[model samples]
Target: MVSIDEVARAAGVSTATVSRALSGRGQVSAGTRSRVLDTAAALGYVVSAPASSLASGRARNIGVLLPVVDRWYFSTVLAGIASGLQSAGYDITLYALTEDPTERAVVFETFLRRRRVDGVIAIAMSLDTAEADRLAALGMPVVALGAEHRQLPSLAVDDIAVAKLATAHLTDLGHRELAHIGILHDVDDGTEREHIPSLRRRGFEQALDAAGIPRTSARHEHGDFTIEGGHAAAMRLLTGDAPPTAIFAASDEMAFGALIAARDLGLSVPGELSVVGVDGHELSGFFGLTTVDQFPHDQGLRAAREVLAALDEPAPPTTPETGPAGLDPLPFDLVVRTSTRPPRRES
Candidate 1:
């Protein structure tokens, strides 16, 4: 098999020059770098991660923690992080914290403490005070994805503003009766699922108030962030005595369920009821659902970059700060589609 030494010999360069050129680090003449790369590619030479890590005294790996891997949003973010890290010559180790609290404890108490990774990126999993402290005490750089930590850096979207924009979109379309389907978790989704709901719910109510529409308890229902849950919730809401003219699902998956529910009830989309959702899910375009695009993949990429920066510095916190810690709120865009339109008047 071809090796770095062979590539260096063939390229007529020293081993140090070959290393610098192949790794794209240090200074090397452009001509020499090109020759080394051509020689290595022709010989099918591959760089050894272990050797590189050993030489640099760094693992060259980043640890990513996610509550669940099957979820679309989290998995999309993970993919973005993986792609970004891979492009930057870093490897990823994923730690899935299922519903087991003990496993989560082990991750915080032991796995992260082992110093096996240069940095840690957490996705949507809110670390408790103790867990945050324990990880912080490790002194490794930490970046939170989609959730904010006071001590760590994070990337996410403004949930309240997203809700307001979605609600306002429906209100502007002449829909006075509207409903919101949001996640209700027994445990928080780690990003103020507990607090964000209240804020977004308030935003929804505020939009209604501004439009001179009365806020009613009947207009609110909580889903489990799943299509089936959304279908069930929307089924109940739509079948009620006074059905809403439009529905704003907190996520595209739920909005998809609502779409299905609308179909099952013999209702015509936009003609009978309008639907909107957040989280620019890939399928949203296919489903023709109007939505607020939160760009979760970009959030993950930004969070990974932040983690890399923190790992490069590893600074200590000195002062108490106000507001959400580690929170880098990403932007959102309202994407209109065929799913939403003016409320229909009785023919």
Candidate 2:
């Protein structure tokens, strides 16, 4: 019912000053900004996004790309990004890159190229060299989350190191016969084992080697990064002739599955089989699961910060932090709980 002009008239400020104050963009004195805001609030006046875009040459919207929106990691990161962007007065446009290659192609070739957003933040999607070039060609700042891109600003944890730490925790607890539940694309879930999962597998193997434990093929199972997948994998391993004393799941979801499977098999946790996982999943505490806490939400916040900084600067954005062994790997911690302990002595 009201407009910017009415608010500007009430506040005794120019329309441009009202715009600057409302958008928090250009120079406006504190007193003027306060008055303008009060007037706009009193008058129920709202700034038009289209008009603002036309005037500032910015959409004030950031595009976010994710492989799947249903997963815990993806959803949690999105929540963080949403809160951070809202506080900074920016909007978000989400693009869910489906499993189909054609669908993903459409997102990059069409959706992202529409010139509607000022920046992009992609989460753990396997963007190849060509895809990365296409994103860069958009001429907008792009930041990658949970994966490293040499050309884009990124935030990622050292998956290999985190995995090794999880495995080492089990080994230090006298888990000589240990197994790992990891992601494998050949499975029904069609999970990808390119970046984080693959790196974690390598770390698991390295830890086993360092502990002088044999890295047997029998000790590995592809869980597809899901609780159900981990349950199935644990079912098979636990029923085997020589079951492992402990299991290291690449993700907390899988570890939760392993815990369930152990319980189903009448095996006592930490007493019969120790389990450990990565990701500080919300349910981890309730489950009393020992885990490596990779703060996905924080990664989202950092990625948003990087995008905002790039958008504010006149120059090109700074190079992103790479991972697996970055100069500064994203923060992570090993949380010990009831799920893991030194393997029970063989009577």
Compare the candidates by TM-score and give the number of the best one.
2
Per-residue CA lDDT of model 2 for 41-61, tens digit only, reads 888887788998998888989
Q: What is the lDDT of residue 347 in candidate 1?
A: 68
How many clashes (backbone atoms < 3 Å, residues ≥3 apart in a chain or on different chains) does model 2 have? 1
For candidate 2, the TM-score is 0.92
Q: What is the lDDT of residue 37 in candidate 1?
A: 89
Clashing pairs in 1: 149-325, 150-325
Off by over 4 Å in 1: 184-199, 311-328
In model 2, what are the clashing residue pairs, if there are any? 153-320
lDDT: worst 10-residue window of model 1: 318-327
Report the alpha-carbon TM-score of model 1 versus the true structure.
0.90
- TM-score (all chains, Cα) for each model: 0.90, 0.92
lDDT of each: 0.82, 0.86
Q: Could you tell me the lDDT of residue 279 within candidate 2? A: 96
In model 2, state the lDDT of residue 339: 95
